[model samples]
Target: MSLNWITLRVRDLEASLNFYHDILGLPIERRFESRGKQIVMLGTGAQPKLELIQTIDQTLKPECGVSVGFEVKSLDEAIEYLKSRGIPVLRGPITPNPHLRFFYILDPDGFEVQLAEHS
Candidate 1:
């Protein structure tokens, strides 16, 4: 079976949207309100989408040991883009081998995001 999507609980829907949709450049595929929660799915509709959910009655905190990863064509360009936006790299540019390089950064709600380049 193939993966469909991954969901993240966010404190502010607009902030999350700004990061994922505007900054990361994911296109919003679908968005709607459901049972007092706002949900948005962003992706190209070819691969698995990233889902963001926000609710008013609950305070959401990102959990440890979980992160979402995306592949980049150039690790240097990705790093420069993030730096231009004032987002600091939390860890890495680590190379496990000659064919791969990666790094981590925190999303708006402080969830780790990994950007990797594979050669």
Candidate 2:
């Protein structure tokens, strides 16, 4: 048995669409609305990828302690891009250890996405 996909319940589809696809640069492949809800697929070139599905609650706030970590070629580069796009960084890429460095940022939906670099 294997996991297939994880769906995040998003309050605002437009806001999440810009954050995941525009700010973070995830490639959006498809989008559609059904049963009064919107769904968008983001391809990661791998199975068990992420799908951001939109619901009706626009004021919903995500619960604490749920984090998503994504690694990039250069954490600095990502930081710069995010800053330019007006995304606020909540923490640092400061060296926590010799093998780990991460910075956390809150998306529009209050989801924590940790951008980290492992050397």
Candidate 3:
């Protein structure tokens, strides 16, 4: 079986939309708005998309049991861009065992997303 999309509950629709789209450069496939609620679809290229749904919970905090590790060509460049934007970068572009270089970032909702170079 193949996995489809991962959905996230975002605190602020506008900020989340700006972060995932403008900041991260993920393209918006589609969007729907109703009853003060919003659903945003994000994708890179033609790959599977991520669903960002606005949350009604004002106190919701992004948690970590599982985190998405995104593969990039260079972690250094990715982290630099985030740093330039003043985003909180939790860790660094270190070679863990010579097979990967990775780091973590705290998204707007406090969710941890990792950037890595893996093969």
Q: Estimate TM-scores for all models.
A: 0.94, 0.85, 0.86
CA deviation > 4 Å runs, candidate 1: 57-59
Give the distance in Å from residue 108's predicted Cα in candidate 2 to where it truly belongs.
1.0
Cα-based lDDT for every prediction: 0.91, 0.81, 0.81
The digit string of per-residue lDDT tens for model 3 on 1-119 reads 66668988887878888887888888999999868789998986657788899987987767756466677887778888888998868977578787878888877888778888885
Sorted on TM-score, highest at the top, how do the candidates line up?
1, 3, 2
Candidate 1: the clashing residue pairs are none
Better of 1 and 2 by TM-score: 1
The CA lDDT at 7 in model 1 is 90
Clashes of 3: 0
Tens-digit lDDT track of model 2 for 12-35: 888988888887788887888778
Let me know the TM-score candidate 3 reaches against the reference structure. Answer: 0.86
Worst 10 residues of 1 by lDDT: 55-64
lDDT of 1 by residue, 1-119 (tens): 99999999888899999999999899999999988899999998579999999856365667667799999999999999999998999999999999999999999888999999999
Worst 10 residues of 3 by lDDT: 61-70
